[model samples]
Target: MKKDLWIGGEYRSAASYNELKNPYNLELLAKIGSASQEDVRLAISAAHQAKTMMVEMPAFERAEILEKVARFLRDDLDECARLIAMEAAKPLKAARAEVNRTIMTYTFAAHEARRIHGETVPMDAAPGGQGSLAFTVREPLGVIAAITPFNFPMNLVAHKVGPAIAAGNSVVLKPASQTPLSAYRIAEYFHTAGLPAGALNIVTGSGSKIGEVLKKDDRIKMITFTGSPEVGRYIREHSGLKRVTLELGSNSAVVVDEGVQLNKVIPRIVNGAFAYQGQVCISIQRIFVHESIIDEFTEQFVSETRKLKAGNPLEEDTDISAMITRGDVERTKQWVDEAINNGADLRLGGSAEEGIFQPTVLVNVPLNEKVSCEEVFAPVVHINSFRDFSEAIDLVNDSKYGLQAGIFTNDIHKALQAAKKLEVGGVMINEIPTFRVDQMPYGGVKMSGMGREGIKYAVEEMTELKLISFKTE
Candidate 1:
């Protein structure tokens, strides 16, 4: 399949195109048109051109358009799943799950569109006020630039595009190079679902080239990006007063407390730490288990990790597959070697088998190791023993990235304390840090980036508050 840029509701071919292949087997899946800088500028112009129509669009109209998109996605779940698996090398099961989440995200956007309103305030409460009424209304930002990551091609784009449409803003989306097909496919759905011609433009090509134009373009009212911290910082620095929302990197941590049901948590932690080849932003990287049960937990965790099927993502039972790139596999191997060199124990598979990076677990890794401190973005995790719950909190907080953290325990007091002191964006008391639904407000703190990304919260970011008052003198 040849997937080109979607500009102004039309599919246009670019001067050049990039080969998108199956990450697991290197089979050519599609050719994505490479948008030149001029093409990106044109996409921006198109979105800006359509902003007026979007502004005049009624709430019900916008809600119905999103509802149509949800229906389209729901009807074509298997096709979307196959595309995602073929492009991202995600396990087939995981791809189906992402498709379902995408449908939910758009559905949530439909509901939020109807709820995009403001509250009334009684101006008579002031001392000098009389016969006056006041209220605030949300106005859409003109156009939004959505730069998404490869880890979540469909649903993450839905997180941006769904809410932007619901809030009555046009969007120029530049998805990641490796997974551009999902965005292109969704653009087709949106155009068919009766969205305005220029309401959403899908620009394919180099993110840097497009971002260079997007950052300086005054027509772009806001930029919503999800990727590494470095790029997120670059956007924040260069965006120059345009509203910006970033969902950046995370080296998420998980705590296993003593007396926690080892059987219950063993499987959950295994999946959280290594699912989808650990490409998720909130994949568990640092684990601090209570010293009392650390030995047994590690034993059971390794047992479960070894049980995961590793091979082609097209296989239904596959749990671990090739990462987005071969370079990441080498980098993961290097980090594993570094940890082993620094006195860490390699508990399970760390080598590449059949072009797939095996799920690796480590023990006694130093806190300063790259796999421990930095976002590995690979299927590797390290387990360290903590003396107490308080110490576990400190260990989890000892990082630059504060996206999310989790603890497995039944103690309510300990859970509350962890919740208060974890220093991450969300604290999961009994669930893994990867626990996120479509409607929950999701984001990070510190270097992990800022802004929230649920349907309602994103609508808030994509709109501006305007106050109206009636005064009688």
Candidate 2:
């Protein structure tokens, strides 16, 4: 299959192409166009050109367009799942879930488009203002540069593109080089749904070459990115005052308190820690457990880890698959080795056979180890025992990245306390940090990047608030 650059609502041929292969078996999947400097500039220009049409578009029309796209996604859910599984190496079941979530994301964007409204303000509260009426309205920020990652390609793209359209903004999208197929398919959906020409342009290939143009382009009004912390910082520092919504890295933690239900909790943690090979930004990497229940928790967790099927992502029974790249697999192994050398106990699988790294577990991990401190974006988890409840909270907050954290406890006060003090954007009570719905306000603090990325919140970020005052006094 050949995927050309999506420019101005048409597929254009590129000077060069890059091969996309399956992460598991290296099977040739598709040949993606390698976007050049000219292509990136063209994409930017196209989006800038379409800003007027997008701005003039009515909210109901935008809502209807998104609804149509959602229907298209639902109709092709199985095919989209297969595409995601083949390109991104996600398991079949998980890929289907992502497609379903993407459908909801577009559906939510449609709902939000109709609800976009301004609030009335009272300007007569001051001493000199007696009869002045004021109100504030949200307006689109023009062209948006949306750079997505490989992990959750379709759903994440929908998170950006759907809301950008809802807010009446044009978009120049750069899907992760590893998985551009999903982006191409999505662009086709929008084109079929009757989006204006140049409203959304997708340019594939090298990130550095394209990113240099995206960050420095004045025509691009905003840049919404989800990737590594380093890249997010680079875009922020270089983009000047362009609005940026960056959802970056995290080594998310989960607190397992005493008196927790083991049978129900262990499977959730295992799924959270190992799903999609833990490529998710909020995957549970660090686990702080109460000392009293630590033994039973560890036993069941290890037992469950052993049962997960590791094979091809196309197989419906497979629970784990290969990492996005060999570099990522090697880096994960190195981090695990460093943790073991620093005195962390390797309680379960620690080696990689073939391309898939077995779902691994560690105990007694030092807080300063690489696996503990850094965003291990892998299928690895480190467990620590804490005697005191406050101590567990402290351990969860010790990281520099504060995306999200989870706590499993029956006590209402403890759950609320964890929610308040976890220092993360969201605290999931009796659930894993990986739990996220399509319509919630989601982002992180500290090194986890800035801005929120749910549909309604993102619509707010993609637009500027303008206040109009009527001086009737």
Candidate 3:
């Protein structure tokens, strides 16, 4: 299959191309465009033109287009899921789940487009504005540059592109180099669903080159990036004046209070820690268990982790897949080794095979260890015992990345208290830190990210608010 850059509503080959390898089996899937500076400029110009056309499109029409895209996605669901599984190294079940999530995001965005109503501000309530009538409406913010990550490539792309289109904004999407095919396929659906030319463009290339060009472009009004915190900071520093929504890295923690039922919570914690090989931003990197139940929790958690099937992602029965690459596996192993050297105990699954690192569990981890403090985006969980809820909360909040945190407590008051005190963006009670609904406001409080990505919230972020006033006698 031929893969090329999608520009101005058509597929255009780049001056140079790069090979896309399947992270799972190391097979060359296809070669995609290594978009150049000129290509980036063209994509930006196309997006600007598309944005103007999109803004003129009636809200209802945009909603119709999105609804059609959702339907088309359902029609091609199997193909989409297979492609995602092929490139992203996600297990078959997880890849299927991501496809379903992609559909939901588009469906929700379609419905939200019609509900994008502006409110009338009561000018009469103001001290000197009794005679004035004022209200605000949401307007498209021209061109949006959506830079999605490799993990959950299809769904995260939908999270950004769906809302951008639904809000009548044109998008220039730069899918992760490792997994660009799935996103490009989705962009094709936009065209087949009769979305206007230039409304959605895909540029596949080196992030450093294409990303810098897009971020530096003045016409690209907003950037929605999902990647590492290091890259996110660079984007913020270099990109001037334009709006940016960054969903960055996280070292998310889940606190299990003594008030919780151990039997039910331990399994959930295991799933949260080991799922997707723990590549998710909200995956439980650190677990702060109340000292009373620490031993019990650790025992059960290790048992459950052992039961997970680790192998090829394409295999239907495999519970865990390879890390995105061999480098990822090595990095995870290094983190485990460093933690062990720094007084942390490797409780279970610390071995590596080829490109697969075993799902690892570390106990009695030092507070200052990299595994405890850094964003270890791998299938490794660091365990620490806390004597009190306050101490657990403090430990959880100590990280700079406050994306999401979980508390397993039966006490409603304690749940509410943790919800209030936790510095993360979302809090789940009786659940692990990995819980997320597509409709919820999903962004971090601190270094995790800047803006929300749910359908309603993302539409708000993708558009600009404009107030109209009139002088009356």
What's the lDDT for all of these models? 0.93, 0.94, 0.88
After superposition, the stretches of candidate 1 with alpha carbons farther than 4 Å from their true spots are none
TM-score of each: 0.99, 0.99, 0.98
Candidate 3: tens digits of C-alpha lDDT, residues 1-473: 66989999999988988888887789999988888989989988888887778988998999888888888888888778888888988888888888888889999999999988788888878788888878889998989999999989889999999999999999899999999999888888999888888989999888998988988889999989999988999999889999999999999899888867787888888889888889998999999988998898899888888899988888888888888989988888888898898889889988888677889999999978888788989999988899978888899999889999999887788888898999988888788889988999999978998988899999999888999876564
Q: For residues 248-320, could you state the per-residue lDDT of candidate 1 as single tens digits?
A: 9999999998888999998999999998899999999998999999999999999988899888888899898
Per-residue error at 364 for model 1, in Å?
A: 0.4
What tens-digit string does per-residue lDDT give for candidate 2 at 1-473?
89899999999999999999999999999899999999999998999899999999999999999999999999999999999999999999999999999999999999999999899986767786778888999999999999999999999999999999999999999999988999999999999999998999999989999999998889988999999999999998999989998999999999999998999999999999999999999999999999999989999999999999999999999999999998888998999999899899999878897789989999999999989999989999998999999999999999899999999999999998888888999989988999999999999999998999999999999999999989886
Ranking by lDDT: 2, 1, 3
Report the error of model 3 at residue 304, Å.
Answer: 0.8
- Tell me, what's the RMSD of every candidate? 0.9, 0.9, 1.1
lDDT of 3 at 132: 81
lDDT of 1 at 117: 90
User: Relative to the unseen true structure, what is the Cα RMSD of model 3?
Assistant: 1.1
